[model samples]
Target: MDTTVNGEPRVLATDAAVALIDEIRRDYPDILFHQSGGCCDGSSPMCYPTDDFIVGDHDVKLGEISGVPVYISASQFEAWKHTQLIIDVVAGRGGMFSLDNGREKRFLTRSRMFGGGEACAIPGVQKVV
Candidate 1:
């Protein structure tokens, strides 16, 4: 799958992550990701069945990985707007309430800062203030 939407990608997934996502999709066809900001989950990416969690109006959609939409709270987006989120799978427990819970591995969020002259090109992401 293409890692980018237009010219740049705001989010991406590793091969392992894509495999895990495909495994999860077998059980839950419609799933999405929400990047938690240092709450109970300690900044891990939370996965859920699309209808299970509500996407708040202030949340920003950061494009898709493995065909699943990824989002972050508007507040968190401001803090991470300059980085590209790389979704990876690691050996550990997932968030207590996340769909990946109970699975042997969990989804992890890794990131890299955008280079000079490279701006966030994803649609719907606007500069806040």
Candidate 2:
């Protein structure tokens, strides 16, 4: 429920996303998501068992999406800080390493920029290396 401008927990989920996350939890209760900066997954939000991916100082915790911790690269955070990320589920295969893969559905991240009063107070995000 926390939405600090730059703080962790900036990412949120839609009903569909939450449902999908719950479904994934059945098999992998400790899963998490990291927005791919590029390369292997082409910026898709990749899901994995939390213990699988290593969070480093360069990664910033954006927030929790559907109870799953969501993180983005520090550089991406600098570019996307003004926007709010909304996680959703769409029909398709996700990144091969993502837990959602092979499920006929993939997790998606949609974003919108803050407006008006909110534009000036984009909160700071936190990082857990």
RMSD of each: 7.0, 6.1
Off by over 4 Å in 1: 1-6, 116-129
Across residues 20-113, which tens digit of lDDT does each residue of candidate 1 receive? 8899999999999999999699999999999999999999999888789999999998898877888888898999998889998999988768
Among all windows of 10 consecutive residues in model 1, the one with the lowest summed lDDT is 120-129
Off by over 4 Å in 2: 1-3, 6-9, 117-129
TM-score per model over all chains: 0.85, 0.82
For residues 41-60, write the lDDT of model 2, one tens digit per residue.
Answer: 78889888988999878988
Query: Please, what is the whole-model Cα lDDT of each candidate in the order they appear?
Result: 0.82, 0.75
lDDT of 1: 0.82
Question: What are the clashing pairs of model 1?
Answer: none
lDDT measured at residue 46 in model 1 versus the true structure, 0 to 100: 96
Clash statistics: count for each candidate: 0, 8
